[model samples]
Target: MKISLQINASPYQHQAADSAWHFIQAAILSGHDICRVFFYHDGVFNALRDSRPPGDERDVVKRWSELHAKHGVDLVVCVSSAQRRGLLEQTVAKKLGGYQSALADGFRIAGLGLLMEALIDADRHITFGD
Candidate 1:
């Protein structure tokens, strides 16, 4: 099955991000294809490159990065949402004089068109959080 995920909440403050990660892992293990993972609203925070969770806690952002690295998943952060949260892409950041390394590895900043494309192409479009 082809699946795409939409995440709308911040990591740590809610279980959405963690749950989505676990679900993605399980789905892949079951031989499913994850077409894309779209981060919107507060969920855009999951793509922050400098997120440093305490040693005892699971680094959700790093986990996402690793997942993308291992599985070649398309991790996309909504451009508007990311900008609203000050999570600028490299080019945008450089142009705006903002932090250029705001996003983690394997994640790209894009528009809702990408999300719509995922929804159209995937067999299932699952959403996490509000």
Candidate 2:
């Protein structure tokens, strides 16, 4: 099955991000395809490049990056949401003289069109958090 995921919560603030990550791993193991993961609202924090958790704890952002690297999953952060939360795309940040590398590896900032496309193309569209 082709599954698309949308996460609307922050990594540490709620269990939604963790649950979604585990679900994606299990789905891939079961031979399912992850079409895309759309990060909206506070979920955009998961794509922050400089998010540094303790070495003993799980690095949520890195996990998402590795998922994209290993499985070719699309990790998309909502452009408006990110910008609102001060997480700008590299080019936009550079233009504004802000942090240029705000997003982590393998994640891209885009408008809701990509999210709509994923929803339209995937067999299942699963949302985590509010």
Candidate 3:
């Protein structure tokens, strides 16, 4: 199945983001396909490359990168939402002179139009947050 997981909450404030990762891993292990992951609202923080967690806390950003590399997952962040939260990819951040690079290596900066296309083309759309 082609699964599109939408995350709409910040990574630190909720467990949905973590759960979504686990679910994706398991689904992939079980021979399922993850179509794409849409990070909206505060969930765009998950793609931030400079997110530093305490030693005891889990590294959600690293996990996301791993998922992307391992599964060829298309991690799409909403353009408007990312601009509001200041999530920039490395190239964009360098060109635009931002202090931080929010998008990880495998993630891409996209618009809601892509999300709409995914919704239309994806086999299953699962939202992980409110």
Whole-model Cα lDDT of every candidate shown, in order? 0.93, 0.95, 0.86
> For model 3, how does the per-residue alpha-carbon lDDT over 26-98 read when each residue is reduced to its tens digit?
8899888898999999888888887789989889988888888877899998878987877776667788895
Q: How far out, in Å, is residue 12 in model 2?
A: 0.6
Best by lDDT: 2
Residue pairs in candidate 2 whose N, alpha carbon or C atoms collide under 3 angstroms: none
| Clashing pairs counted in every model | 0, 0, 0
Writing each residue's lDDT as its tens digit, candidate 1 over 14-84 gives 89998999999899999999999999999999998999989998899899989988999999999999999
Clashing pairs in 1: none
Worst 10 residues of 1 by lDDT: 92-101
lDDT of 2 by residue, 50-101 (tens): 9999999999999999999999999999999998999988799989996677
- Best-to-worst ranking by lDDT: 2, 1, 3
Best by TM-score: 2
Task: Name the lDDT of candidate 2.
Answer: 0.95
Ranking by TM-score: 2, 1, 3
**Candidate 2: segments with Cα more than 4 A from true spot:** none
Error of 1 at 111 (Å): 0.2
